[model samples]
Target: MLEIKDVAFGGKAVGRLEDGRVCFSPDALPGERVQVTVTRETKRFVEAQLDRVLEASPRRVKPPCPYYGACGGCSYQHAAYDYQVELKTKQVGDVLGRLGGIENPNVLEGVPSPLPYGYRNRITVHRHGGRIGFHRRDGKGLVDIEACLLASDEVNKRLAELRRERFHEGARVLREHASRMGFHQTNDGVGALLQDAVSEACGSGGCLIDAYCGDGFFAHRLAKKFQRVIGLEWNERSIAQARSVAHANESYIEGDVAARLAEVLEEADGAATTVILDPPSQGLDVQVADLLRAYPVAKIVYVSCNPATLARDLKSLAAVYELGSATPFDMFPQTAEVEVLAILRRRF
Candidate 1:
């Protein structure tokens, strides 16, 4: 029996074993005593399987999805939606402090998703051996599913149509609509909040350089705030789309960010320039970080999907930038994933 102390960043509850070794288990909540069987043992910690809940937490609730445990897509289904946000908010601060080495990180409350379930606009289901669904929790094989509760009605309708027919062994992506080819956030409502946060941080500037700006998602929205908005992207399709709807003041460049960012920064007004970085899960490239430090902008609004990588990059930029605020958005609720927006100001 172990007392679940805290829920880690990956939605796993952490506890200490009787032998003083740390133990991690899923499907367990903090403040609950659970009986677990050791599955894997390492020198530092042990992985366990939750056998029984000796004491359940008040935050625990019955998962609406029938395949909650079996499906690996949603981890916090058993946890209350509000509690999940709270945990995510705390996890951001914890990760920043632990990984970034920032003392007493100022992490604001997490912005919750309007619709906890049925919010995803897109999902990819794997078809293996005539089974069409997501991978199992253990990731060993695919679980045949009829409907996904997390997907929107439109997406679910497409999934139902795909299920009725037979397909070969491959992954089929089901989306509500045939949007332009590029990356888009699965949750629409929370994604707007994310954009608002980035926009608010950007405020008004002489020039806006949106790095990794896909289809001018933030650049176009924030174009009015600046005399000119320049967007940088690597995808030819995304750049074309961004230029198709480009405003008189907006210009998009297609190429590697590391290669083109320096020229964009050199041309922008250094005193009133603001750069919005919405990089991939890997965070900023080493060259990009070095460039931002070399050419300090007035402000940098960073949007990240992975906290660990965000924290790592923030630590690297501490010398040139001072963190103003770090806010998290529960863009992907009922899962371990979170989107954080950090605003940084150049240090004199």
Candidate 2:
């Protein structure tokens, strides 16, 4: 059995074994004395599971979810909401300070979800044989979930209906397609909220270019505020859907964003422009960064999932632009993940 010592980097407790090796345990908070059974002893660190609480931390509370321990959806649902926010804030600060080499970075308070429970717009439910739910945290076993507290009511309702039907290969395709279309209610209406933030930041009557604008989610909304809105997307299926819903004035081009940006810039020709980038987690390529720097855009709104990559790209862009403000959105509550939107303006 191991005793909890202090909070480690990834929200786990760091403890040492008698043999002079380190160990880590989940569900074991800092300042709590717990007896943990060693599950696996590795060369560097040992993995353990909580066996008994010799002494529980005051921050510990009853987990609301029925499948808290088994389901991989959430980790901190066992802790109180306020404490969860505090932990997340610390995580963001730590990553930026330690990894990004940014000292005492001003991490704005995280934007809280409108409704913590039942706020997810999308949920990918796994299916193998008759089982349909999330995979177990440790084992290959599947935990069949009838109701998910974090998923929207629409997803839960659709899941219930889908379960009644016999499992077929075609059902998986249909479910996956539906989930990607954003049919469920999300926290703070994520799509609308992002669009509103962009609009407010950009102000009225200017050309706006969106990169990786999936299904015209933000482009459609920005069309109302901008004089002209152009969206670049690679997915033909998403482009088709976007075209179907796109406003008459809004234009969407189906191609690589990096390749199309040059053409868009040539066409715009020094018109007041604002670029909104929502790239993948790997972050923008060097070529893309080069093109963005070359373009005479007035401002850039970079939305990123990985802060490490964001910091790298921001350093590159810092040659021409100055950091304005950063706002973090808690899209994923449980894990060590956060979505941040940073606004950058030309230094001149």
Candidate 3:
């Protein structure tokens, strides 16, 4: 059994073992003394589950989800909502300062999600055998979940209907064949809020080029703010969706982003462009990085899910563009992941 000591980086409790090694315990908050059972141990640290809370922190709250600890989908739902925001902000600041080498950087206050719960627009329910839900934190077990508090009501209703159809029977097959394309919108109101923020930051009188544009989300919304909007996406389904929503003033191309941007720029008639890139957690491809540096865009807005990769990409892009501001968004409130929105202007 382990006793909780203090809070560690990922909102887990840091406690030392009898042999002087460290263990990280989830569901054990700071200022709380708990008896924990070591589930898995490693040479450096250990992973534990809370066995008993000898002393409880005042910040602890009742988690509304029944599958809270069993399902790894949400970790900090037991923590206070306000405290969740605080921890996320600190995590972003630490990543920027420690990894990005931006000391004393002006980190904007996190853009809080309008509705923290039931905000997720999309959810991937995994099914192996008769089980369907998220995998356990230990990555070894599966917990069947009937409903997810994080998913939007619409998605939940759809999920229920899908389940009634016994969709889990051929989940793997359906997932493979599903067009994998649809309008991407956060069931939560955060997408709209993010659109507003991007619009306000970029302002008017500039062309906006969105790389990695999925279904032309921001491209469709922000086309009015710019003299012209051009979107580049690799997914054919997403490209088709974008085309369906495209106005006469907006254009979208389907091809590899790094390879196709040069041609897209040439076709733009030398318009000054503001580039907004929202890449996956793997971050930007090196080839794309080179293109951004070579082309002189007015401003670049980079939206990223992983801080470590974002820092690395920013460090590489710093040579060509001046990093103006960074705002972290708590898109995934309960998890360690954060969404960082960075604004960069081309150097003269």
TM-score of each: 0.98, 0.82, 0.86
* Model 1 spans with C-alpha error above 4 angstroms: none
Question: How would you encode candidate 2's per-residue C-alpha lDDT over 1-348 as one tens digit per residue?
Answer: 566776554557778888978888888776777888889888988888888888887888888888888987677776666666666666666666666555676677776555667777567777876788887877776788897888777768878987897765322422323636522223445545666676677675778888888887777877888888898988887788888888878989998987888899878744488888888888888878888777767888887777778777877776777667766766666555667777888887
Indicate which candidate wins on TM-score. Answer: 1
The predictions' CA RMSDs to the true structure, in order, are: 0.9, 3.6, 3.5
Ranked candidates (lDDT, high to low): 1, 3, 2
Q: What is the C-alpha lDDT of each candidate?
A: 0.91, 0.74, 0.77
Pairs of residues clashing in candidate 1:
none
How would you encode candidate 3's per-residue C-alpha lDDT over 1-348 as one tens digit per residue? 566666554567788888988988888776777888888888999888888888877888999888887787777888887777766777677777777777765678888777879788677777777787778876886778787888777767766766676663434211222354554644347667777787777776657888999988888888877778889988988998899878888899898897898876665533377888988889999988888877767788888888788888887887877778888887876665678888888778
Candidate 3: lDDT of 233?
A: 88
Candidate 2: deviation at residue 55, Å? 3.8
Candidate 2 backbone collisions, by pair: none
Error of 3 at 210 (Å): 0.5
lDDT of 3 at 268: 54
Per-residue lDDT tens digits for candidate 1, residues 1-348, read: 999999999999999988899999998999999999999999999999899999999999999998888998988998999999999999999999999989999898899999999999999999998789999998889989999999999989998999888788899889886774787777989988888888888999599999999989889999888899999999989899999988899999999999999999887777789999999999999999999998999999999999999999999999989888899899888989999999989998
The runs of at least 3 residues in candidate 2 whose Cα sits more than 4 Å from the true structure, single-residue gaps closed, are 1-23, 38-47, 169-188, 245-249, 266-271
